[model samples]
Target: MSTSNGMRPETPETPDHESWWSRIGTLGQALTALTGLIVTVVPILVATGLPGQDSGNSNFSPTVVPTTSQPYTSPPSTTPPPQAEGINLTVSDQLTDGAEEEVIVITLEGSRVATLHATREQPVVSQRVTATRAGNYSYVVDAVMRWYDETGTEQVTNATGRGSVSIDDGTRLDVYVHEETDGISLSLESATQ
Candidate 1:
């Protein structure tokens, strides 16, 4: 392609097929853009749903579909029942007219066994205690008495008693608290096996 100056004339490349080729090139570019949009927007649309609607389930969400089901049964407990003998200890109050209220605390072998509240009308309380072994158990009783003085002021007195009793199987023991001439005294009244 030489001209008068011995150089090629300036002209468009592929001049004969430019019109059809450019349209096809444009269509290829459009297809590439549409493919890129699908690749980007389809995942986004699937991850987060449409603008106002709820997002669909996540791919990582776990769904459980049971194939076979049976009624659940609980396991049995392993603890055993107590097998030692016990004693039914009884407390009776013998306060005549000097006290309005009394609180008796009984402790067996340094551990609190029971606390008995005795009033004027009801002056008896009992509790059954289980012994791991058959022997004489030492007990301590602490008593508090409350009454009114002549001037309408309240009066208080405290007394304590210590004793030991033999407890056998199916034994019932009775202890009594009496208002003595000095103060109060706790004594084992009787025991029945």
Candidate 2:
């Protein structure tokens, strides 16, 4: 039926429902964009020492490595399994149960080895550290205690201990950190393999 204004009968507008092919085309475009992003990111990650980078260089100096050993075949177990030559250390903190402590960081660095963190906790500090070489090693144990002064503003008391340990092939030593009236004392219990 025609209106008095001379307009034709109108049909209701239909909302557009995307078709399967059109959806697939959109998915293909997204996939292409994602592939391009991944392609661009991988080289950057490799260059920046990220996931895709190699653990070490193949052309490392021959003068550095005097001996050649076979690669490790299996995964490492819980206990420190004995290797041909290495030092395995177990550090135990003998501080009083309720002693004041905040951030504690213990490190051992020297002689055929880099730095190793023994403890980074409170109340108690215990950890297992393994090093591939055996020689004289120096350690730096640092800790901080936080407390409120008379004015109620937070204040910190820091403590540091320096010591040395001797290690040999396939040696295992237990280091005890004992708190004394003056400061912390580091003593070696014994050595074993």
Candidate 3:
């Protein structure tokens, strides 16, 4: 009269598949604490607003725009063309008129001319002349007295005379003349533009 169902008495429970895995681990810890309280009250309700106040606001007003500019032009000027005139001559000393031949003639002003000759057995003579004209001009210097007076016929006049002129654009002018002892002196050192 005894028990023989594997010696009976042996019942420690918690089974039914551990109460269905303990109700699925308490429903995954209540859905991870409701997703961490909705990720910490949704940024504190978008940074304070519900009973935490100050939701940002400073009468906002800032906007300005306007700009335009364009206008200015000036440049054009040129001038040139005005110059042409020049004359030069020189003769200093030795143009005697004692016993014969002597002639010094220099005339310029578009008609340009130059001649010089001295003789009393060759006294002295020098000459240099040039000019074409471009504005104002007048020149004349004569010293003639070519003689043979004992009636062999032949005698010239202008024993001594002087004159001058200038105002050129063809460069410059330089004049010099000297033959004293009964006259003939003229000078106008230099002139240019």
Candidate 4:
């Protein structure tokens, strides 16, 4: 439209620079959306597996085939650690005078494991007692010694001894009995392993 003087007045031209700037903003938004889509879709495709992918390959499967993080190892030892078998116990006596009906009772952990009987002929007794674990073990010994008096009459005497034996694998415990001044007594002679 012309002004009253019949001269065409200037009209502001639409800024081409603003159009360029808006185009750039639109391009940036498009790029951001595309990047977000790639980030979201790639993980899903890798996890659930892509369509038409090879099922024969274990790497492509959704069900995780455990790769041995460590090399093949023998199954954890089924057999337990070695345990002690038993203890060998021997009871020996030194008696000069002839005796009759000699009896020795051996108690382990308050349980009678052996009751050894010997006469003047044999004065030694031995047996194996089970002790599968390790620790201090207390035992008891009861002995009855019999001998003839000067009058040729039968006489009896009772003796007892208390001792502790440290038991391990292949342990041997020895106890001895001897005649004292008043009566008979018992003693722990030695312990060997």
Per-model TM values vs. the true structure: 0.46, 0.35, 0.25, 0.47
For every candidate in turn, the CA RMSD to the true structure comes to 19.9, 16.3, 35.2, 21.6
Clashes of 4: 0
Q: How accurate locally, in lDDT, is each candidate?
A: 0.71, 0.59, 0.57, 0.70
Q: What is the lDDT of residue 190 in candidate 1?
A: 41
Report lDDT (Cα) of residue 93, candidate 1.
Answer: 50
lDDT of 3: 0.57
Q: Which is superior by lDDT, 1 or 2?
A: 1
What's model 1's overall lDDT? 0.71
In terms of lDDT, model 4 sits at: 0.70
How high is the lDDT of residue 148 in model 3?
72
Superior candidate under TM-score, 1 versus 2: 1
TM-score leader = 4
lDDT of 4 by residue, 151-187 (tens): 9998988888888767665666665766678766675
Candidate 1 lDDT, 113-180, residue by residue in tens: 77777787886656666656667888887888888988989999888888888766566656566668
Worst 10 residues of 2 by lDDT: 111-120
> Which of the two, 1 or 4, has more TM-score?
4
Best by lDDT: 1
**After TM-score superposition, what is the CA distance of residue 124 in candidate 2 from its true location, in Å?**
3.2
Per-residue accuracy of model 2 over 110-145 as CA lDDT, tens digit each: 332222222225444556667767777777666555
Model 4 scores worst on lDDT over the 10 consecutive residues at 87-96
Candidate 2, TM-score vs. the true structure?
0.35
Residue by residue across 15-66, what tens digits does model 3's lDDT show? 6776755676977878888999999999988866666566675655665444
